[model samples]
Target: MTKHIARVLAAVLLSIWAYGAHAGDVIRSFNADILVREDGVLDVTETIKVNADGTDIQHGIYRDFPQYVTTPDGTRYKVSFEILSVTRNGEDEPWEATDTDLGTKIRIGDQFQLVSTGNHTYQIRYLTDRQIIFGDASDRLRWNVTGDEWSFPILSASAHVILSSGAQPFEPIAFTGSRGRKLADAVATVSGRGATFETTHALDPFEGLTIMVQFPKGAVAPPTTAQLSDWWWRDNLGWVVLIYGFAAVFAYMMFTWLWFGRDPKAGTIVPRWDLPMGISPALMSYIFDGMNRPGFTGDL
Candidate 1:
C-alpha cells in the first residue's frame, strides 16, 4: 500500500464504524485489500456479504475517491466517483472520460452497460472506477496479514476475503467494533454519570461517512456511562430517595432551630409574674409616685 492508501485504510476503518448509525437496519460482512501502483493510482479489491435475506443485493462501485460511504451490504451507497485520469503502460488512452457520478470505465468496455446483479454479491479482481478503486474475486489472494483488524460487539460474524498476493505497506487498526455510533444533529438525554464509549459497529465503503472516536489512548475499549444509580431504580428513585432523606433531616433541623427548643428570654415576657407589679422595678417607680403614702413628714 502506498502512503495515501495507508492513510485511506484508516479512513475506511472509521467508515465501517459509521455503518452502525442505525442498528438492526443492515448487517454486513466484507474484506478489502489496498493496492498502489507506481503511477499513484490506488486499487482496492473487496468481497462483501449482505444480510438482506431473500432481498436482491444491488451494489455499485464509485470511482470517485475520498468522499463517500459504503453500506453494510457492501453497496457504494453515498457520494459520487468522478475519474480524473487513466493510463496503461505509461501511455495515455482515449478510454478516459468524465462522469457526473461514476467515472469512465477502463475494463468493462462500457459503463453501466455490463453492470450485473447476482444472487449473493460480486468479487471484482480489477474492478477499477478511478485511481482509487476496490474490487474482489472468488479467487482469494494470499496476502500477508500485517496485524489484527479491530471490531466490536464482542462476538462478531466475519467473512474473510483475500486481498493481493504481494503485501505492500499496511497499517492495521487494532480493536474495532462490530459497528459504530454516528454523530449527527439529534437529541440525546444523558442521565448516567460515567463516560459513554463511542465506537463504530461495522464497515461502510461508499459514503465516506466514517465513525471516529477520540480517545486519549489509542483504540481502547469505550468508557461506560452506565451509572450505578441508573441501575438502582426506575425514575432514578434511588437518587430521589437520597434527596428526600437529606431534605427530611434538613427540615427537622430547621424546625428545631426555629421553635422546638428556644431560650425563654427570646420571647416577650408576660406581666403576670407571682411578684406584684409594684415590687418590680418596671412599675415600682410609678406605684410609689401614685401612692403618695410618703413617710409621715419625719413624725412632725
Candidate 2:
C-alpha cells in the first residue's frame, strides 16, 4: 500500500511538470513591413518567431487580417485580402486562406505534421486594399501590425510603414496594449518616405501593436468604383449571382404582366340603366360586373 501511494504522488508531479513546460511558450518576435502604393494597395509582409513547446502551437500559427470596416456614419466598406505566399524558416510552408467572421485567416503549417519544439519563424506575404483612409487634407493609415488575439505574450514587436517613392509621411504614432487603450507604449520615427515603430516594453497576452501614419493629400488615391466592384464580385460571387438571378426573374414577370396580362381600359364607363338591344340583364351583369354572382359564365 505504501509503494502504491508513493508511485501515485510521483505520477501527479510529473504531469504537472509537463504541463508547465508547454504553457510557458511565448512569441519572441513579430515584425511587419507595409508598403503603401499610389494606387491604394498595400503590400504587407510579416515575420513572426514563436517559441513553441508543442501545446497550442502544434501545427503552426494562424494570422488574421481584417477585410471590412464600418464608418461612423453607418457605412460599411470592403478591404480586400490577397495572399501572395508563406514560408517557414526560409522554405515554403503549406498553408491555406479562409474567410472567417473576424477576417481573412491564413492557417500556416500542415495539418498532418506537428511543429518541432523550440523557436520557429514564419513569414507571410499578402496584399490588401482600402487600408488607407483618404481625407481632405491627409490620407491616414491605421494598421494593427500584430493583431491582439494572440494567446501568448509578445516579447518584442515592430513595424515599418513605407510609402511610394518621392512621397513623404507625417504624424507617425503607435499604441500598445489592449484594443482601444490609446496608451503610448512604442516609439515612432519618420525617415524619408517611411515610418518605423518599435515597442518600448514587452506586450502581454491579448495586447497588440498599432501604427498610424499620415501622408499629404493626393499621395494615396482612393479606390475607384471599378476596383471596388471587382473585389466585391470576387469575394461574393455566389451571392451576387443568386441575387441577380432573382432580380432578372422578377423583372421578366413584371414586364409580362404589364404588356400582356393587364385588362383593357374599361370602355369609358358610360352611365346607362337600360340593357343593350340584344344583351340580356344577366349577360350584362356577368360581362361588366365580376363573376361572383350565381350562374355567371363571364370568367369562362
> Evaluated with lDDT, which candidate comes out highest?
2
TM-score, cand. 2 vs. native = 0.72
Could you give candidate 2's per-residue lDDT for residues 1-300 as a string of tens digits?
Answer: 999999999999987975564356788889999988889888999999999987678998877777768789987666778889899998999998898886788889999999999889999988988788888888899999999888888878999888874588999999999877876889999998789999987788889999998899888777689987887776678788999999999999999999999999877677767777999886787798746666624763
What TM-score do all the candidates reach, one by one?
0.24, 0.72
Q: Name the weakest run of 10 consecutive residues (lDDT summed) in model 2.
A: 291-300
**Tens digits of per-residue lDDT for model 1, 1-300:** 599998999899867865454233232433444343322223544343333322222222222223234547884422223334433223332233344333233231234333233323323334322222222311111221111222211112221221222322222122331224333311112122211111233333211122111112111121134522332343356568999999999999989988967666666767773657447764665565747655333553
Top candidate on TM-score is 2
